[model samples]
Target: MIAVCQFGGSNCDRDAVLALRHLGFEAERVWHADGLPAEADGVVLPGGFSYGDYLRAGAMAARAPILREVCDAAERGVPVLGICNGAQVGTETGLVPGAFTTNASARFRCEHVHLRVENAETPWTAGFEPGEVLTLPIAHGEGRFEIAEDTLADLDDDRVLFRYCNEAGAVTDAANPNGSVDGVAGLLGEHEHTAVLMPHPERATLPDLGGTDGRTILRGFASEAEG
Candidate 1:
């Protein structure tokens, strides 16, 4: 079963559960205060305005008791997917490197974006091919990915999952939706199964919703579980 963490202000928890269920995984919304289930084979930190975006987008929720279980699950090599606000929590908790700060425009953005696959072998991108382009929705006020120069240089090639790009797969400043450094859109954490991305894969998972390109990413859970 996949546990989708639902914090106080998490607005996308249901969407995540539905998307996962559509893909044949047993998924359910697990309230943040309730702790994770022992049967959970994967954990999803869904998008939200946790704690009303107080202190920071995901700062408070990142410290909640349930997060410990999430961390332990990741340590055991279970898949942990963090989306949008959850991406902020992932970075805040050091589950991944870099910080997600205010957008370059310092304004909230909501739109579809193209991303080029950087590491097709990682579970998060296994459904895609190297250099392939995927269109996904993004909505956030602070989605910029900032990393120290040395840290950026030290990241393994496989650590990068996807980068913002044009429809044709060209990585350029013009294609950047929120001015993320290097146009990075997603990243793999210390373990290949753990990933965080500032895009709404669930929003793009259902064909009736207009697109299903995001199934490529969410399917990582099934891939990891089967492995």
Candidate 2:
């Protein structure tokens, strides 16, 4: 079974789980404080204000016992994804290098923004076409991604992934909503088995919500797992 890590302060656990189930996977949520589940095939860190965003969104939650096990899982090449606050945890844990800071706006804002898929090779994005615009929801105070210039170059060369204009089919800085470095919304893991993104794809999993763009991303993950 796949395990979705859920911390006490994580509010989107159920949504993640629901999306996973919709995709026909057997998923379970494990508390962030507990050790990683022994039988997890993959792990997902859903979006939320773990510890109420105290001392940075995921700073305190990074040290939780479950995260240690998650680190172990990541090193073993288990597919893991961190979304929003979960993205912060991924950065803190070194699953994905760099960190997220308060948005240029300095306050939490929730709205739909356009996202262009810059990389279609990752498992989570395999179903998307390069340069596709996906209307996804973003709600966070800290979503800006910062990385060293050298690493940024490496990411570009390796196609680690990037966020682009959801409307113009272009990767322009102006379309960026949170001022993420390089207009990045998602990135591949060092080991190529993990993915972390600030946008909440899970929130857009159903047609009732007015969009199903996220289904492709999640479907890609399951297809890779099956393959």
The prediction achieving the highest lDDT against the true structure is 1
- Output the TM-score of candidate 2: 0.94
lDDT of 2 by residue, 1-227 (tens): 67788887999889988988987887888886677878887888889989888888898888887888888877877788888889998888788888899887787878877887777777887777877788888888899989998888776444455584648767677777778887888887786678888888888886698687878877766565444
Specify the highest-TM-score model's number. 1
What TM-score would candidate 1 get against the native? Answer: 0.97
Model 1 clash number: 0
lDDT of 1 by residue, 6-112 (tens): 99999999999989888887888999888999988889999989899899888999999999899999999889999999999999988999999999998999999
Question: Which 10-residue window in model 1 sums to the lowest lDDT?
Answer: 218-227
lDDT of each: 0.90, 0.80
lDDT of 1 at 100: 94
